[model samples]
Target: MTAVETPELDAALAAAEARCARQGATLTPLRRQVLRLVLEAGQPVGAYTLLERLKERRGPAAPPTVYRALDFLLEQGLIHRLERLNAFLPCIGPEEEPCGHGCGHDHPHQFLICTRCGATAEIADHDVAHALTAAADRLGFRPSRATVEVEGICARCA
Candidate 1:
């Protein structure tokens, strides 16, 4: 909605394009547009909202079309599903190496979600990972996926 340009978003779009090329998949115009919208948002975006925008820009779109594109993006790790909010956000960094069951091999960065505005911010901290590892070791369990999400009001909202 804002015209601000973010370096992070530029990098993400480049990464997505590269990934699509490497996978021999064409990032169609519609798909590219949708991805751009999500990246520009800098927060979680609902599928229905994406659909509405797509319809406005492209004229007459179906939910299936948007969902299909989203599925493709997610599969390629270009986007991530925010399960708690039932929304989607563009992935910020390298694709996490998948950890099958619970071994902490591939983990998503922690998210600080703003309850008031529904904005999601990524939190990267080695200490938090270390603490989780230590706790898991004590329980004789290794986490395959490590995601930490904290929800509260953001400064502006507060």
Candidate 2:
């Protein structure tokens, strides 16, 4: 498995630290480990999954220990939470800012979820989101989030 924490990992970490600095937040050691685990997994992972992994390396890690870090990462947009799967995956690239409501978090994205190997990839189309949101406004419909998860087998699995 190609670990996501490869050479690109350094750039991601730097971007995250800069973003936190702007937001007056600190990337604690525990939070950094959580982010590393998610990225290294190269797939969506649940909090318990991370907790178990952490325990193997750092001894007994409580649920709260992992949860707190997950929460912080989510708030910073260093990671994305898949509502349907109740799991999290790292964003495609380094994020310079948090993805809050209206901060482009609603950017239309088709999350490709691979069932066989449990991998996930987010395909975002900013133009599509703009067009869809505009059309909705004309029809008097308000849309908040534009992310959609499409499930299927990945090429590797096939």
Can you give the TM-score per candidate against the true fold? Answer: 0.72, 0.78
- When summed lDDT is taken over every stretch of 10 residues in candidate 2, the lowest stretch is 95-104
Residue ranges of candidate 2 with Cα displaced over 4 Å: 92-106, 131-139
lDDT for each candidate structure: 0.71, 0.74
Candidate 1 lowest-lDDT run of ten: 96-105
In model 1, the runs with Cα more than 4 Å from the true position are 1-11, 93-107, 130-144
**So what's the TM-score on candidate 1?**
0.72
lDDT of 1: 0.71
List CA RMSD, all candidates.
5.5, 3.7
lDDT of 2 by residue, 107-146 (tens): 4566888888877777776776788889999999997666
In TM-score terms, which candidate is top?
Answer: 2
Model 1 lDDT per residue over 91-151, tens place: 6342322111121214446778888887677655768998998999999998876767789
